[model samples]
Structures are given as structure tokens and as C-alpha cells.
Target: MAIILAITNSKGGVGKTTTCANLGAALSAAGKAVLLVDNDPQGDLTKVMRSDPKSLKYTLANLMNAVLDDTEPELFVNRAVIEGAGIHYIPANSKLAGVSSRLVALQMSSRYRGGETGGTPCELVMARVLELFQSQYDYILIDCGHSMDLLTINALAAAHQAIVPVQAHYLAMEDMADTLEVIQTIRQGINPKLAVGGILLTMYQGRTNLCRGIQDEIQADYGNAFTVFSSPIDFSIRVAEHPIGAASIFAYEPNNPAAKAYSAVAQEVLSYGQK
Candidate 1:
């Protein structure tokens, strides 16, 4: 049931690591089976998957301290895996930005605040890194790290969904009103199985006019909550020379036009995984 997501945007060059490395390599070139999790420590999706995540040595901070000792966390997973058409990677390091204050002080002294933290402390360590891979990938995503703390609150409490690439300037729709009021206060408290998984539009130029007036002011305000991607991603130059030239405009041109606008935003995210 892997459908995680969480591409986030508290604001930062607004391509969110090139839309999480070309929508996890365009949903693994549309065959699915992707993974991508680079919870951004400025690793830039493991340096655009060209390696040198400080020369890796098992990352995701040893899968968050072996899921805080309950262990069995994919045995500190490390594939260093590099497939081409059906993406898979967990390679994010800058030492994962010192794993958010040791996972917010070890889930703040734990009693199960959420799991390792306990009592649902905003989805404790992203639900211990999504219960060790959420039954192995079909799509996990998560490329955050623009800011909000605790690694964007454990990737929006381990996401059930979230996109927001944004960029067409003019304060990118006023910084998406504080990231949609912090995703509407994390959907009123903490993840109500989350949603808003759309709103891409990165780097667009559309022959200017303030980039089509900020895409008609982000579809005249949130466009009925969200769902904007109708192929926009522009301002190429091979996606601005891929994170210091590693690669990803779905490997430099999976049929251009910003890789077919992330393959029509990954087929509008597989039509929301068929509802």
C-alpha cells in the first residue's frame, strides 16, 4: 500500500529537489515501484542519485537509529541501489541533517508518543520511517527540507499525501499562505489521513507576463483546494543543470518539456491511486 508522497514546500528554490528527482524518475518510468525518500538534509535527493552522499555508509541515519532500537528497521537498509527506469533510492545524506535533533530528542523521552517518540508526536519519526518501507514501494516519495523543523514535522507526519512544487515567483503565491497554514494545522491536529497531493508548476516561463501572472494567481487561489498540474514545469536548461550536474529531468530528457511535465504529473498521480 505504498503511496506516501510528501514533496512539501515551506519555500526553497521551489523545485523541491527537482520535484523529488523528477517525480521519482517519473514514477519509475511509469512502471511504478519507486521509493525516493531523501528527507532532505540538503543531500538533494542523494546528490541527484549520482552518488557521493558523502560516500554513503548506510544512511537515512541508519534508518533513524534502527527505528530507535526496536530495531528490525529493514536491517539498516542500504541498497545504494540505482535503477534507471523504475527508480529506487533512500540515499540522502548530509548525515540527514543530523536527524532532526536526534529525532526530536528521541521522540522526546518516549512512552510511545507516536511510536519511538510516542502518543502520536506528529507521526513519530515518520512512523519509524514508514513501518520499514510500507510493504515495499509502489511510491513513497518524500523529499522535503525547506524548513518547519523536525524534518518538516516528520515529513508532514509521514504523509498520506502532499505535493506543492510552486515557482512562478511573486513570492510564490505568498509562500503558499504559510504552506497552506501548515497544511491546515496538519489537517486539524495531526494527519487526518492527509490529502492535497497536487499543485506542481515548477520553473515555468509560459512566455512570461509574470509567468502568466503567477499561473493565474495559482488558479485564483488554491483552485478549489488543489490539483493544478496540467503540465507546466519549464525553465529548463536540462532542469537548471541538475543538482550540480548529476542528473534528473528524468535523467536529462525523458521526452523533455520538463519531462512531459512530470509525465502529466505522474498521470495525475495515477488518478489518485484509483481513489
Candidate 2:
């Protein structure tokens, strides 16, 4: 079965996209067939995959648009094959940002919306993707946009797990409650198999009491949500300036402590649902 994880943090700059890309890379490197779904409308993950989408043929937006056509769903998805890394990426674009409103527009114009058994069109798009593509991947990692809107809901509905990346900042911690509430609601109704994959503490420093305090508070609230996540991503320029398609910390500096941390988390995720 494909292990689908939605990498999201309601707060931005918390390493969600980085985690998704790198985890996809790491898992693919470990001989797993990984499919990375760039669900972020910002197109950051897509930029990371293609470095530049200007030259790409079809993006996630196109794929979603093609859902209405009579074609194999994968035909619409861009299968970006990274050399030596058994990975596939379904790239997104800035155009994806308007998807929600367009979907809402669909609701207002379609008779389906007025029906008794009507449902959100956004929710169905990803379910179709999963039914068609999940079998081809050992892991499908969805890199969500920075909001709990329709796209995130669609991603959450299609995935089995969610990995929330949080930074060691006071304000960032506040968003955790709302995000978790959304997760709880999704789990209760939409996707019963969904669970908190883990809470990753990013931008951390062991020397700060602030880091420890935040970790403690989170654990207190969610019962030690992170079992094997890394300490902090640290203040590294390399992490920020890496070229598109370049390997993340795992490939750039696998020996680094931060890389080791992400690898540990990757290992934990790999062990999920195992006997």
C-alpha cells in the first residue's frame, strides 16, 4: 500500500515543503517509489522540482483540469524523474492558487451543487488522483500550500497521514491548535485513517531554553507528538539557496546533524503501520 503523507504547517517557513521534497528524495534514494504531489499554490515545491516551471509541459493545475477529460489521470500529471532517485513529482504552479475560487464557481454553476447528495468538487479531484496514482508509488507526499483551505482539505482527504512542521517560535505555536482542530475534524469525518504523523520542530537550537519550552508545551498538549523528529533545521544558508532539483540536506550534507535528524524522522515514517 502507498503511504501517503501530507506535509503541512498552517504557519509558513516551517520547513513543510523542504520536508516533503527531501523526504521524497530520501525515500526514493532508499529504493522506494516516491510520488511528490506539489499541492502548494505558491509553486515553491514545483520550483524546487523543476527549478523553473517555464519550460515544463504540464503542471498539477493542468492535471486537475484534465480530470474532466477521458484520459488516464497519470497522463495529465508530470512525472518528473530525478536521476538515480526513483522519484516522481506532480508539479504545481502559481495558477493553482486560483483553484479554490474556480471550484467554488463550479459549485454555483452546476446542478450537482443543488442536489441532496452533493459534495465539494475540490474533494473529488484528489480522490481521483489517489485512486489512479497511489498504486504506482510506495510513498505519495503532498506538499500543501500555507492555508487550511480547499486544496489542503483535498490533500488531507486523499492522504493517510499528516506531518506538521512547526518552528520554535511563539506565534507559530498558536497555529498548531487550529491546524490540529482541522485534522481532528478531518479524521473524525473525512479520512478515518489519518493521524498525526509527527510534529517536527524546525529552526531549533539546543542552546535556547525557548526550544525546550516549546517542545515541552507541544508534548504536553498532544502527548509527545514527535517521537523521532530532528532538533532544529538550524540557520543554514545552503538549505535556503539550494538549486532546484538539488538534493536536500540528506544529499547535500548527509553527515550533518540536521540531515541525520530528518533521516531519523524519515525512518520513523517508514516504520509506520509495520508490525
Candidate 3:
């Protein structure tokens, strides 16, 4: 079975998609079969993986439609996956924005018709779709949209764990309490098996005292609840340019500090899985 992990944060520009792309690449480089799922409507992860969302004939939206129709998941799972950068992924585009509304309509219709115990709700659809691929990959990484919407909740419901990438700044650290509360709520109500993989510090600058202070504060506040990774992703121009080159940091510049840092974090993740 795959260990499904969601890379998510409520705030944008915190490197959630970047971490998902690099971590999937690094894990694949370690000889693990990886599937990166773009759960965000923005399609940033899809573009970074060298896929053009506009040209894709099939996408995650199609799979969600099939799930809503109660079709066999196996019949449509492979058709939505695009292979690139040593991993398989289901791309998402703006069309995915309608899925949540459709799911809500389905629930309403079920209530009116008294059909089949309301079927599967919107929040559990992603979990059902991912169940089809549990044995096919070693890791399934979901790159979530930067919000606490139905889509993000579906990702959380489907995941075995979550990796929160927080920028090393005072404001970002202050917003983390709410994000952790949401995760805790999901674990309690939807997925009891969901664990916090770790808290990763991104866009870190060692030269800045403010960055160091925020890192120390995060450890002191949440270290008992979740593991805070020691290897912080440093600020790098190469990382920003990775998507344009259609590659991960490990592939774009193997010797880069950000690449090495992600590799170390991947090893830490592997060790956690072993335990």
C-alpha cells in the first residue's frame, strides 16, 4: 500500500507545491514508485511536472466525475495519469472547480430521492479514487490548493499524513496554529489514521536572525505534537526557476543547497515510514 501524503498550507507562496514536486522526485530517485496528485485548481504542480493542463485530454476532474457517477474507479484511474519526471500524476485544471458543487448537488438529490444513504460525500471522493492506486505506488503525494475548501478537505481525508511547509517568518508562524487545528479536526472526524508527517521550514535564510527565531519558536511550540524537520530549505533562485525548466531541484541542479536539503528531508521521511 502507498503512504499517501498531502503537502498543504492554508497560506499561499509558502512552497507547498514546490515541496510536493521535489519530495516526489527525491523519493522516486530513492527507487520508490511515486504518484504526485495535483489537487489544486491552479495546476501549478502539473505545469512543474512538464504537463500542459490546457492540452490534457483527461484530468482529475474526469476521475471525480466518474466517482460521482459511481463508475468503476479502475476503468478511469489509468486514463487520468500522466507520466513524467520519473513519476505518475493526475493533473488538475480550473475545470476541477465545479466538482465540489456537483458533489453537493448529488447529496441534495440523494436526500430528496432517499437514495442509498446519501452515497459518498464530497470530502470522501478523493479517498475513494485513491483507493484504486494504493498498491501501485510506494508514495502518493497530493499538492493541495491554498485554502480550506472542499478540495483541500478531500485531500486531507485521503491522506495518511500531511507535510506542512511554513515560510520562516513571524506572520507565517503565527498562522500555523489555525492550520494545525484544521488537521486535528480532520483526524478526529474523517481520518483517524492521518498523522502529521512533519513541519518543514521553507524559504529559510540562515543569515537572518528573524528566520532563526521563527524556527526556534516553531520547534518549541509544536515539537511535542509533530516532528519539525532539521533540514530547512534555503532561499534559492534556482528553486524559483525549477518550474520553468520543467524539473525538480534534484534534477535541475543536483548540487544546489536546496536539493541537498530536500534529499535529507526525504531520508528523514523514509526513516519515519520504517518506524
Candidate 4:
């Protein structure tokens, strides 16, 4: 079975999509079978992996909807899984917003409340889709949106662990608390095996006093509770350009310091299976 990791944060622009793509690329380069799942409605990860999201007939939303309708997802799952930059991935688009709303509606419905629907729980809809792919890959990385909505919750419920990417800033440190709390809630109420893989400090300017201070604060606050990855992703234009360039950092700029940092992160992740 794959070690499923959700690259998530409750705050946007914290490098969730970037981590999901680059980490998968790094692992794939290391001879691991990687599957990236774009869970965000913005489809940023999909855009980075797929030349055109609209050109695809199926998506993550289709798989979720298949589970919602209690249909065989294998039909759509195969078509949705596409390869890019040496990683297989399921793309997402704005249509996922409708799926989120359906989850909300189901949560509000008495039929769902009474189990009359007799289908997977709203929070586990994505989990049902991912279960089919779990055994086929070494790692499954989910790129989540910046919210604790049903969609993000579904990702958490499905994942074995979460990799939180926080920017090296005081405010980002503050946001980390809410993200951890959500993970804890899921661990307590939904997936008991769910663990936090680590907190990754991204957009780091190690030379700056401010970045160093935030990094220290994160390590001090979260280190004892969860891992604070030793490797901090250095702030670089190359990272921000990967999605636009439609390639992972390894493909875009293998020698870039940011790529090396992600490779370090991947090493730390691989060490998890060792332990």
C-alpha cells in the first residue's frame, strides 16, 4: 500500500501544490511510483501536471461523484489518472466546487443523517476513490485548498499522514495552529491512524533575521509536538515558475537550490517508511 500524504495548509500560498508536485517528482526520480492527487478546486497542481485540465473528460470530481452515486469508480478512475513529468496524477477543476456543495447538501439532508443514503460518508468520499489506487503506488500526494471544508476534510480522512507546508513568517506560524488542530480532529474522530509527517518551512530566507526568527518559533512551538523538517525550502523564483513552466522543479531546474531542498524533504519523507 502507498504511504498517502496530503500536502496541506489552511492558508493559501504556503507551497502545498508546489510540495505535492516537486516531492512526487523527487520521489519518482528516486525510483518510487508516485501518484499526485489535485484536491484543490483551483487546479493549480493539475495545471502544473497537465497541459490542459479542460482537455480531460474525467477528473477527481468524477471519481468523487461516482462514489456519491454508488457507482463503480474504476470506470472513471483509470481514465482520470494521467501521467506527467514521470508522475501519475488525477486532475481537478472548478467542477469540484459543485462536489463540495453536494457534500454540504448531503450533510444537511435527513436521508444522509439517517443513513438512508447507504453510501460512503461525505467526509470519506474521496477516500473511497483513493483506496482503489493506494496499492498501485508508493506514494500518493494530495494538494489541498486553503480551507477546512468538506473537500479538505475528505483529503485528510483519506490520507495516512499530512505534510504541512508553512511559509517562514510569524503569521504563517499562527496559521499552523489551526491546521494542526484540524489534523488532530481528523485523527480523533475520523482516521485514527492519521499522523502529521512534519511541518515544512517554505519560502525561507535563511539569511534574514525575520525568517530565522519565524523558523525558530515554529521549531520551538511545533518541534516537540510534530516534526519540523530539517530542510527548509529556500525562497526562489524557480519554485514559483515551475507551475507556469508546466514542470516539476526537478524537470524545470534540477540544480536549483529549491529543488535540492525538496529532495531533502523527500529524503526525510522516505525515512518515515523506514521507521
Q: Which one is best on lDDT?
A: 4
TM-score-sorted candidate list, best first = 4, 3, 2, 1
In model 3, pairs of residues that clash are: none
TM-score, predicted candidate 1 vs. hidden true structure = 0.36
Q: Candidate 2: which stretches are off by over 4 Å?
A: 68-74, 77-85, 107-120, 224-232, 243-245
Q: What is the TM-score of each candidate against the true structure?
A: 0.36, 0.88, 0.94, 0.96
Please report, in order, the local distance difference test score of every candidate based on alpha carbons. 0.75, 0.73, 0.88, 0.89
Superposition error at 81 for model 2 (Å): 7.0
lDDT of 3 by residue, 52-161 (tens): 88888788888888888787767778799988868889998887888877866766776777665455776799999999889999999999988888888899999998
Quote the RMSD, in angstroms, for model 2. Answer: 2.8
RMSD of each: 14.5, 2.8, 1.9, 1.5
Q: CA lDDT of 118 in candidate 4?
A: 65
Runs in model 4 deviating more than 4 A are 110-116, 243-246
Question: Per-residue CA lDDT of candidate 4, range 60-113, in tens?
Answer: 989999899999898897889887757899999888999999999888783645
Q: How would you order the candidates by lDDT, starting with the best?
A: 4, 3, 1, 2
* Residue 12 lDDT in candidate 3: 89
Q: Which window of 10 residues has the lowest lDDT sum in candidate 3?
A: 110-119
